[model samples]
Target: MTTVAILDYGMGNLRSVAKAIEHVAPGHEVFVTSDPARVAAAERVVFPGQGAMPDCMRELDARGLRPAVMQAAASKPFLGICIGQQMLFDHSAEGDVPGLGILRGEVVRFPDAAMQGADGLRLKVPHMGWNEVWQRQPHPMWDGIPDGERFYFVHSYFVAPADDDIVAAQTDYGLRFTSAVARANIFAAQFHPEKSAAAGLRLLANFIRWQP
Candidate 1:
C-alpha cells in the first residue's frame, strides 16, 4: 500500500485533514506525523497548515522537519494546503516571513482598500466561505473535479508565483488570485479540500490516485 504522510508541525486542524484523506483514501496507508524520517520515507507527502506564517516557519524549524519536507517536495508526489502552500514559496508578506523557497513565488495579502466585491460590498479579509476556482491548466488533480467548482477558503494572504507558468488555478474575491499552483510532482492549493465537502473529497481522491 502507498504510505501517505501528513506533515504535522503543530499548525492547523491536522486531524481534520488526516481524516479527510483517510475517508477518501481507504486503500492507502495514511498517517499524521511530525517525524522527519517518516515524512521522508512516505510514498506521498501532504503539507497542510493554518496559522501565522512566522509561527508556522518557526515551528517547522523547531521540529526539524524542514529537510524532509524539502526532500519530499522534490522527490515525491507532494501536496500542500492553506498555509502549507504559502510555506513552499520564497516569501510571504504576512509577518514579512520567508518560506521554504521550494517554488519561485511570494505570498501577498489582499489589499484592504480594494476589498469591494462585484456587488460593491466590502469583502472580508480572511476570504472565508466558498468560492469558485477557475482551473488555469489541466492537471491530474483536477480530474473529476469540474472547472469553476467552489472550494472552501480562509486566508488573507495568497501566493503570487514569480513565474505565472506554474499557476494551475485562480479564484476571485476582492481580486483574482492564484488559488492553486502545480509544478512537476508538486501540487499545492490555498483552499481546504477537507472542509470543501464533496468536491473537496473528490480532489483528495484524485490526489490519492494521481501518479503525477
Candidate 2:
C-alpha cells in the first residue's frame, strides 16, 4: 500500500491535512510525523502550514526536518498547503524570512492599495473566503476539477515565482496572484483544500492517485 507522510513541523494544521488525505486514500497509511526517517521513507510527503514565515522556518529547522523535507520534495510526490506553499519559495516578505528554496520565487504580501474591487470597494488583507482559481496550466492535480473552481483561502501573501512556467493556477483578490504551483512531483496551493468543501476534497483525492 502507498504510504503518505504529513510533515509535522509544529506550525500547520497537521491533523486536518492528514484526515483529509486519509478520507481520500483509505487503504494508504497516512502518518503525521516529525521523524525525518519516516518522512524520507514515505512514498508521498505533505507539507502543510500556517502562521508567520519566520517561525515556520525556525520550527522546521529546530526539528531538524529541513533536509528530509527537501529530499522528499526532490524525489517524491510532495504537496504543500497554505504557509506550506509559501515556504517552498526562496524568501517571504513576511518577517523578511527566507524559505526552503525548493522552488525559485519570493512570497509577497498583497499591496494595501491594490486591495480594492473594480467597483471601488476595499477588500480585506487576508483575502479570506472563496475565490475562483484560474488554472494556468494543465496538471494532474486539476483532474476532475473545473477550471474556474473556487477554493478556500486565508493568507495575506502569495508566491511570485521567478519563472512563470512553474505556476499551475492563479486567483484574484484585488489583483491576480499565483494561487498554486506545480513542477515535476511537487504541487502546492496557497488555498486550503481541506476547508474548501467538495472541490477541496476532490483535490485531495486527485493527489492520492497522482503519479507526478
Candidate 3:
C-alpha cells in the first residue's frame, strides 16, 4: 500500500489536504505527520503550508523537517502547495527570508504597479478567489486538465524560478506569475486543491497515481 505523508510543520490545512487525497486515492494511507522520520519513510510527500515566510521557515527548522523535506523532494514524488510551493525557492520577499533552495528561484511580492489592470482597475494584493492558470508547458500534473483552468488562489507573493523551463503554468493577476512548477518527481502549485473543486481534485488524483 502507498503511504502519503502530509508534512505537519504547524502551518496550513493539513487535514483538509489529507481528506482530499483520501477522496481521490482511497487505498492509500494518508496521514498528517510532523515526524521527520515518517516523512522520509513515506512513499510520497505533500508539503502544504500557510502563513508568513519567516515563521514558516522557522517552524520547518524547529521541527527538524528542512533536511527531510529537501531529501524527499530529491528522492521521491513530492507535491508542494501554496506557501509550501514558495518555500521551495532560494528566497522570499516576505521578511526577506531565505527558503529551502531546493529550486533555483526567489519569491517576490507583486509590485504595486503590477496590481493595476490594463483598464486601470486595481486588483487586491492577496490574489484570492479563482483565476485561470494558463499552461506554460506540457506536464504530467496537467495530464487530464485543460490548458486554462480556474484554480483557487490566496497569496500575496509568487515564485520566480531562475529557469523558465521549470515553470509548468502561469497565471495573470495584473501580471503573469509562475503559479505551478514541475520537474521530475516534484510538482508544486500556488493554489489550494482542497478548495478548487473539480480541477483541483483532478490534479490531486493525478499526483496520487503519478509514478514520478
Candidate 4:
C-alpha cells in the first residue's frame, strides 16, 4: 500500500484533506505529520494549507519542514491543495511573501473587480465558494475528472507559472487562471478537492493510484 504523508504545518485544513484521502484509499497509509523524518520516509506527500502565504511559509520554516517538503516533491509524488498549491511557486503577493520555490512563478490577486460579478463586488479579496475547472492538458492527476467540473475554492491569490506546459487545468474568476498544475511527480490544485464532492473524491482516488 502507498504511504502518504500529509504535512502538518499548523495552517491547513489537514484533517479534512486526510479524511478525504483515507476515504478513497483505505488500504493506503495516510499520516498527518510535522516530523521531517516521517515526511522523508513517505512514498507520497500532500501539502494542504489555508490563510496568507507569508504565515504559511513562516510556519513551515518554524517547524523545519520546508526542506523535507521540497525534497519529497523533488523525489516523490507530491500533491498540493489550496494555499499548498500556491506555495509550490516562487512567491505570492497576498502578503508580499516568498514561497517554497518548487515551481516557477508567483501568486497574484484576481484582476478586474467586475469579472468576479456584482455579488462579489466591492470585495477585493478572498475569492470564495465553488468554481468550475477548465482542464487544459491530459494528465494522470486529473484522470477520470471531467472538464468544466466545479470545485470549492476560497482564496484571493492564484498561481501564474512561468511555464505554460505545467498547467493542467484552469478556472475563471476575474480571468482564466491556473487552477491545477503538474510537472513530473509534482501535482497541485488551487481548489480544495476535499470540499468538491464526488469530483473531488475522484481526484484523490486518482492521486492515490497514480504511479510517478
Candidate 5:
C-alpha cells in the first residue's frame, strides 16, 4: 500500500525503474509523475535519471520539481538512482552544471589519464557494465543485500562526498568512489538497480520494506 512516485524529469528510464519496483513489490502503488504536487503527496519518492547532470537539473527546475524533491527528501524516504544520485550533490564537473546541492560535494570525472597502467593504457571514462558495490555501513535500505554484489552502472562522473560518514557503499572503477550514500531519510545509489537482476531486486525490496 506504499505510494511511490517516480519523478519523470524527461531524461530517465522511468518505465524500466517502475517496472522493476513493481516486480519487487507487487501490490505497492507506483506512479510516474512530473507534477510536483503528486510527488509531494507520495509516501516515498524515487528519483531516476540517465542523461547529463546539467540537463536533468534544468528540466527539474523548469518543471518546478526541485523544491518538492528537496521537501520530500527532508523527512520522507527518497531513493535516487544513477544521475539522480549525482544530482543530489552540489555540482558536477561533467558540464560545469550545478546540482541540487542536497549533499555537500562535487561529482568529478574518473581520474582516467592519471591512473594509466605500466603500459600507459589509460582507464576509460563512462564506466559501463556490472560493477561490485562494497557496503560501508548498515542501512535499512541495504538490508538483505550482500557485499561484492555486481550492479549495473553507466556514467563518467562519480560522487565525492565531503562527509565520509554519509557514504554507505563504495565501488571501484579506476579508483574507489562513493557509489551509495545515506543521510537520515535520503538514500541514493550510483548504479542502476533496475538493470542489475536479482541482486538489484533485493535492493528495491529493501527500499520498499524500509521504514523511513
Candidate 6:
C-alpha cells in the first residue's frame, strides 16, 4: 500500500491534516510521524506547520528531522500547508530564520504599507477567514477546483517566490499575494485544506490522484 507521511515535528495541527488526507484518500495510509526513518521512507510527504518560524525551525532541528525533510522535498510528491509552505523558502523575516532553500523565495510578513485596503480599511495581521484564490496557472492539484475557489486561510506571512511562474494561485487580503505555488513534484499553499469545505476536499482528492 502507498504511504503518505505527514511530518510530525511538533508544530501545528498534525492530526487534522492526517484526518483530512485519510478522509480524501482512503486507499493510501497516512502516518503522522516524527521518526526520521518513517519520514525518509514514506512514498509521499505532507509537511504541515503552524506557529513562529524560530520555534518551528528549532523543533525541526532538535528532532533531527531536517535531513529527512530535505530528502523528501527533493524526491517526493510533497504538499506543504500554511507554515509548512513558508519553510520552503530560503529565508523568513518572521524571526530572521533560514528555510530549506528548496524554493527560490523569501517568506515575508505582509507589508505595513500594503496592510490597508485602497478604501483605507486596515486588515488584520493573521489574514484569517475564507478568501477566493485566483488560479494563475493550470496544474494537477488545481484539478476539479475552480478558477477562483475560496479556501480557509489563517496566516500572517506569505511566500514571495523569486520566480513568478511557479505561482499557481493568488489571493487578496489587504493586498494580493501568492496563495499557492507549484513546481516539479511539490504543491504548497498558505491555506488550510483541512479547514476548507468542498473545494478543499476536492484539492486533497486531486493531490491523491496527482502523478507528480
Highest lDDT among the candidates is held by which one?
1
TM-score of every candidate relative to the true structure? 0.98, 0.98, 0.97, 0.94, 0.95, 0.96
- lDDT of all predictions: 0.94, 0.93, 0.93, 0.91, 0.90, 0.90
lDDT of 1 by residue, 78-189 (tens): 9999999999999999999899999998999998775898999999888999999999999999999999999999999999999999999999997899999999999999
lDDT of 2 by residue, 1-212 (tens): 89999999999998888888899899889999999999999999999999999999999999999999999999999999999999999999999999999999999998877478778899988789999999999999999999999999998999999999999999978889999999999999999999999899999999888997
Model 5 agreement with the true structure over 1-212: per-residue lDDT tens digits:
99999999899999999999999888889989999999989999999998888899999999899999899889799999999999999989989999988899999988657765346767677788998999999888777778878999998889999999999999877688999999999999999999999999999999988886
Candidate with better TM-score, 3 vs 6? 3
Off by over 4 Å in 1: none
- At residue 39, give the lDDT of candidate 5: 92
Question: Residue 128 in candidate 2 has what lDDT?
Answer: 92
lDDT of 4 by residue, 96-202 (tens): 88888889998998864566554765545577898889999989877788899999989888999999999999987767889999999999999999999999999
Error of 5 at 167 (Å): 0.5
lDDT of 6 by residue, 70-159 (tens): 899889889999999999999999999999899999998986665786678887777889999999999999888888889999988999
**Tens-digit per-residue lDDT, 20-125, candidate 3:** 9999998789989999999999999999999999999999999899999989999999999999999999999999999999999999998766478677898878
TM-score result, candidate 5: 0.95
Model 1 residue 103 lDDT?
A: 98
How well does model 5 score by local distance difference test? 0.90
The 10-residue segment of model 5 with minimum total lDDT is 111-120
Please give the distance, in angstroms, between residue 31's alpha carbon in candidate 2 and its true position after superposition: 1.1
Clash pairs of candidate 3? none
* lDDT of prediction 4: 0.91
Could you give the candidate ranking by TM-score, starting with the highest? 1, 2, 3, 6, 5, 4
